[model samples]
Target chain A: MATREIAGTTVEVNDEGYLTNPDQWNEEIAKVIAREEGIGELTEGHWKVVKFLRDDFKEKGVMPTIRRVKNAGGIPTKDLYELFPEGPLKKSSKVAGLQKPASCI
Target chain B: MMKRVLILGAGTAGTMMANHLARRLDRKDWSLTIVDQHKTHYYQPGFLFIPFGVYGEQDVIKSKREFIPDGVEYIEQKIELIEPDSNKVRLGDGTVLAYDILIVATGSKIFPEEIEGLKEDGWFKNVFDFYTIEGASALREALKDFKGGKLVVHLSEMPIKCPVAPLEFTFLADWFLHTQGIRNETELIYITPLSEAFTKHNCAVVLNYLLEEKRIHMETDFNVERVDETANRIIGYDGREIDYDLLVTIPTNMGDPVIARSGMGDDLNFIPTHKHNLQSKSHENVFVIGDATDLPSSKAGSVAHFQGDVLTENILNFISGNPLKDDFDGHANCFIESGFGKAFLIDFNYDIEPVEGTFPLPVIGPFSLLKETRVNHMGKLAFRWIYWNILLKGRPMPGIKTRMQTLGKRLPKIA
Candidate 1:
């Protein structure tokens, strides 16, 4: 684990840069993470996806996959890609302060 | 009063459960019955070889009744719905059967229709899935007639049954093409939703290098949007398109639709099962095994074989008024056929990644793990016999254990 200064706070993250301490995250951190992921200006559309990830992870104890985010989170697949291009779930979860979805090998 | 144990879907898991309980349960007190719509049981692993003409339909297909234990009643009927609350199952004929215990092994199926335009006119003609015997056979013929063009192997989603088969297919295809004297003419590509050749770190490093060595093109992080049948291409979420002359795809795999109708499955139609004990989260009398459950374990026959031991112990404990055993560690062992008369063996669980080491017999292992060997390839061929004679009969496989074994393995430090 490594520590990163994001949004003026020293928070811990994994080797992949996902937040190790999800509880330490706030909206400010999310915006910074999102910007780094090539997404600019968090719109209402983007917040919904982030909120869904946060809420679902809190309830299920695991980060949801792209299918779950699409099927259960009630977001269209196209909009998700449009909202956060290039591995949307990876970008969204990092911004949402959740660990990477452990893609089962 | 007599108790009835009902098993649904007489595939690998359910059939093994029937045989396991048949002898253990008292003949006078417990009655065993299994239900499935199909009469034939296909050796699913054999399907992978069918495309290369290593296995034929006759070799894989067998009567399901042959493996079922004596005194275990077999019902060849469609299960219409499962009523977990009432401890009953409704058949297609509107007949409801009460169960003291229910084992769901309905398994998963390839749903090509899930994607728009995937099941279009060119489905079997050009785009094919080898998950089924029909698709495998059709692909065999298609490969025979090929003048060698772009052969794209695609994975639509994750958690598909036999997770390694697509990679195996790509490797075998490379070998098959070379044998056909068309290796130079074929442009082979592997497209997946994963960011690399595999999700695990160690395996990915080795597999990615192999892909490069074999000159197979890699397209990663591409979640399929739809199939553009008119143009012979598949469009992903990023709007990236890959054209293919012959598309060998593993379509979105889902649990039986009956789970959806019964209002018990997740978004993918897999039941929410307890990862350790194999019990359904919501229903006490119900247990889930194999691909039907939404476990993190790979959906393969080896997993079902391991789960058989866990479920059997837990069910016996549950029936005897004892607490269920939360002893399953998700042990899964599979041989990755790498072609060129060589294969790789990987054994891991929910926690560990596939690392290099010797397996089963330890340091003196005739078959090495995570390294390609001809012995591993021989193991794959011999498994067909073991699968039918020993595995389905609930006979213990000599070297394997229910939980993941760390002995003889170079264990990785957990992150």
Candidate 2:
């Protein structure tokens, strides 16, 4: 697959709009991938979630579940759903353009 | 016999239109005249940052005459009425200026008086709007003594300049109160008529999260019925009362008074303009731009800049008796300030809503769309300089285009 450029990040999506390279994600593509996954508009506070998700994936080398993303992002469980609205972790991962981690069924 | 074009206001919209049309129209063939009541031009968007001590009054104001080109004649006077049938405009001094073409670019005004009880006792006492030079300066004073309480930032209605400013105010207020050690003392509340914090669904989702994260109280769909200034309470249409110590209300906005006197506007006094062509629905020889028109978009300076380009083409076509191209797709953009030294940029036109994407370039926008970044905050600040030098001078920005592009934007799910 050919690499497409988005804010210095090399992104390649299949017909289903999945990121071929999850590690290649930057802030710009993170928003694009999130919106594509139905996260809608990513606001200022949502950055906390994005940063947390990216950090969790980097350290754990695996995608974080809702519980992990909540703990990592430091946002309350109620606030997480308000921020993601589409069910956190699952929804945010799809929008962040991150590949599904081995932990998630 | 030279063709004379008279532009009614020398503010942001009028100044840009003059700069554009003066260059397009041959000086020998067409005489351009711009009339404004005040000699000073104000950077309106700067008003948003003023209350927070981010921008000073000196940074936002400039002489209106300085921006008008040498070839363009600027007359500082009040317009009494537009005699469109006779192709003449009457001035306050009883001087009748005739024109071959008239451009109505007089921007909007804040009518705080329209809101009962708001202007009577608590005009600038407890309630203030950061939309005008005086209001902004006064709010700065009010903020100085603002120790703590329920600090409510609100929008009276939609169609306000820089729609995100109130949201920006809420964010900045959160940052401001926290820095002052008053965050715990103050209860930050955002009272808007919008179902969410913003108009568009996409942006609203992000804003709702911001309100939640910042611990700012959000009361959506609360249409303010009146303000009980003595009691420091806002009464909503649904009989909901929100108490506040300091009320920063973005008052009702309407088009210039000239539109009402001339009978060229709708109920709200906004000109009825052809959405695409920029031609006034009232007359063929007249055109409307900026906040003067009842366009279903954010009444921001960027939209006027884009309209200036489109109107330039249409005006020439009108002069030549050629078919006018309806090309302006309501391209409006605004940098949403999110405080804590971060901002978000959103660009869209009539058909398209602001979506997540890179702007200017498909994959490499230094500024993020719909997401707050420190760089976007810098861009918003940098625009103040650009407005004075480039945008108002009628020069084309090399990187930025007049048209809104969907190249980088991810298309919404096709329903």
Candidate 3:
């Protein structure tokens, strides 16, 4: 199993550096993961997306889609790009301490 | 002695021709045989969706035997040589099969080694391609960890299968990054040898607008000299450099090596074929289809489907001693995925460029032309099912004509 050092803790990651166990994630770990993803810091807006994704994943047992994120998380399409840069769902999902969304590819 | 028809490859063109000819030709008169190295048939168009994880492995692969109809002999062997003088093909296992007619459907392959440093160091690691199943699968992993950086999507040269695929990848990359929340941090660059975004003038104009809209930096006429891997940049013949953090390139595509060894091909090993009838210029008994033929049309599945229909009739006419008709008009139609659940459809032939139009109907099409719509995206998704069930089986599609029609086309006005 692949592993990554986050916040001085060794966490399991898949071959693509996505979190293997959602339980291993925390607020500090999200900050470290965001930095690694090139997002210098996670703001309140970022946290809103992260929290929404985590809560939705907890309820649905699956990562929310871009449409769901945009609708439920209240993040518009433009703001989503502004926040995540290249892959908002993928980046925010990682920072939000959730598994990679299956529908992304 | 019974007349024999031997097809070289069991791919799209080969499989369709085999199915089409079996029904048309007499059972006792003609014995059809198809030779290919593998038993698995890949829905190659689906390879474009693989890297994006839009399609899984099982979704694109099927047993070749499933599509190859009865009354045809399936020979699983690598071809050794084609002695056109004697009209015989030698298989790798020393079996020589003589044919009354031969169809060359062996398609093009990516020649990664042809480019310097392409196969070295970062291949499948950072620098990757999605042209093959393995390459696409590897790219899925590479794209996962890619945090905002310079992502360069390049085409080594022209005449590659599905020419619009690179642009589709670029557009999807923009969407994919946006979904990953790295669109701001990433710089998406599209490098090509063509002066414009696409092959056609008017189409390139619209595509260039789309590229500008997506903010994908276009570097045109970039004749790649070599990949300077240590410096993480591609050096063109003109000494220009484009650096990349992640490089997804479509390498130089060439016809099967067997075509070269047999002295039956051009500089790129593509068989010189009649653009109209698809018959080989060198031999009347030989017919070429798909990417193997040096046709002026786009080397796409739609062209192959159209050529298959025409070639089937021509082959029958040839057997009956009738004059071959100049039927094939290089008709091709493709759905260009433009990201965000919308896609654009372009339909054209040899003479006409892609114009604003409705397809198969006049101004009341269920699908629009040269314009992006969710319906076109649905059509694009529905095609995979159609390709397997309807197309490969040689069944005619309703309302989709084999010939190009100008009925609903909105032509450019002369100034």
Candidate 4:
């Protein structure tokens, strides 16, 4: 519900710091958000998850679950955790500029 | 030549569908058959009460044969595979049941083996899941011997059946422990993979308040890595650990293995289903109901009951070469047990979150929504009678509607 500046780029974000508009996202914004999430850098594995979240959200109109990311995105859950430490699914989706994954509630 | 409708899994949904189609489809033109491996039809909601000593196994169990409508052939054998390409289902003994239409009602189940060390040394001793009859029975014994340290109730993953059961268990634990004079001694905790106690924003706020009021500790965004039996603690993906005297866990829930064997399911083995019509995404003749479908609705028995109304009509439509009606709105209402003979009733759908209001009546409900009351708990207890007598038989409940009512609901300005 608020706008924030990340790495000299402006984008709207929710209270949880998830980017409200995915179209406003760029590599610079991803890097800055990744840094905020305690992930120092974005590797090839990170972009693979990021790319899947972006494209899948575009097609499905909602954030895919962790199982979907692993099954369809071809990223093993272990590597996903290693790629984005702490919380892989939510963190990756945030860096990917997608909404938080809902629990069907 | 007579057309056949083969229903799978003979559970709550399938039995209802059989009863529905039996009354709807003329016996001269259509024949009905249902299949399952088990003869016992469990009142799944009653499982929550088992651990708290509210209900026994005999109370929840009944002959699956009791609810199945007459003239519908019931096959008490294993379902081997669903060959959607040929519109046939092969049974365990290699018998094939060919059908013009198929209804899948195979519900979700808790799989404890999905996590490392959960089903090992400490299973049923320290770690337990009340989703099954055996698990609940064993947990009853575990609860009996409780002096108490940290009683951690954890949710293993998302999209679980009876989404509110764990929360109910936690609240009931508080009440039970108080009765045993162990409330002060027990450090009750509720853990989840979701970012909050409950997923829906409006409901979460209310539930989180209840958790605080009951003094139950809240832990969020914790994806369990494994249960370390040696140390008697659960390790998270981030290496966070919480020790427990007793661990009541809702393990990974998945669709039946037959869905995977047929190569017709998603990652979780849930068949891809049309949310509105309850039709299979891949095959037109195959319809999915209950937890078998990958619908964004709670996988509770009440949802299966709601789906029963719409799916029956859609099947009748599909039978007569008519277009499938998009009448289902994912309407679901649940009584959330908060213990102490009090509960909260929440009514919601795909687009709307639960709001405060009267349910099924405008300004004159015997039960209130989003507010804990004894009437809601009474309603929940009364549902078991309804489930057995009316719901499973597919008889219409006069007061309830298939779609959600907006009459008494106080809608919030959703952002």
Which candidate model has the greater TM-score, 1 or 4?
Answer: 1
lDDT value, residue A55 of candidate 1: 94
Candidate 2's residue-wise lDDT over B1-415, tens digit each? Answer: 9889999998888999899987899777999999998978889889888887888989988899889988899899999998888899999999999999999988888888766678867778888888888888899899888899999998886667778888988898888888788899999999987667787777889889988999999987666667898898998755689999999999988888877888887656888788899998778999988888877767889988999899999999999999989899888788988889999898888878789988778889877898889999999999999999999998997678888888888879779
Index of the highest-DockQ prediction: 1
State the C-alpha RMSD over the true interface residues for candidate 1, after superposing those residues: 1.3
Q: With candidate 3 superimposed using the best TM-score fit, by how many Å does residue B30's alpha carbon deviate from the native? A: 0.9
Q: Write the per-residue lDDT of candidate 3 for residues A46-105, one digit (tens) a residue.
A: 888889988888875656766567656777645766787656677898888788765210
For residues B1-415, write the lDDT of model 4, one tens digit per residue: 9999999988889989999999998789899999999989999999999998999999999999988878989999999999999999999999999999999999888888888889988998888999999999999999999998999999999889989999999999999999999999999988898888887888999999999999999999898889998788998877789999899999999999999999988778999899999999999999999999999988987888889999999998998889998888888899999989999999999988899999778889878999999999999999999999999999988688999988898997667
Off by over 4 Å in 2: A1-105, B413-415
Report iRMS values in order.
Answer: 1.3, 18.3, 16.1, 1.8
lDDT of 3 at B104: 95
Worst 10 residues of 3 chain A by lDDT: A96-105
What are the models' TM-scores? 0.97, 0.79, 0.79, 0.94
The 10-residue segment of model 3 chain B with minimum total lDDT is B221-230
Task: List model 3 lDDT by residue over B1-415, tens digit each.
Answer: 8999899999999999999998999877889999999889999888888887788889999999999998799999999999988999999999999999999999998999978889999899889999899999899888888888999999997678899999999998999999999999999999997778998777889999999999999998676768977788998755589999999999988899999999998656889899899999899999999889977788888889999999999999888899998899999999999999999999988888899988768888888999989999999999999999988888897888889888899987766
lDDT of 1 by residue, B121-234 (tens): 889999999999999999999999988999999999988998889999999999999999999999999999988887677888999998999999999988999998789998
Instruction: For model 4, state the Cα shift of residue B78 in Å.
Output: 0.7
Model 2 TM-score (B-chain only): 0.98
Better of 3 and 4 by TM-score: 4
Question: Any runs in candidate 3 off by more than 4 Å, and if so which?
Answer: A1-105, B413-415
> Model 1: clashing residue pairs?
none
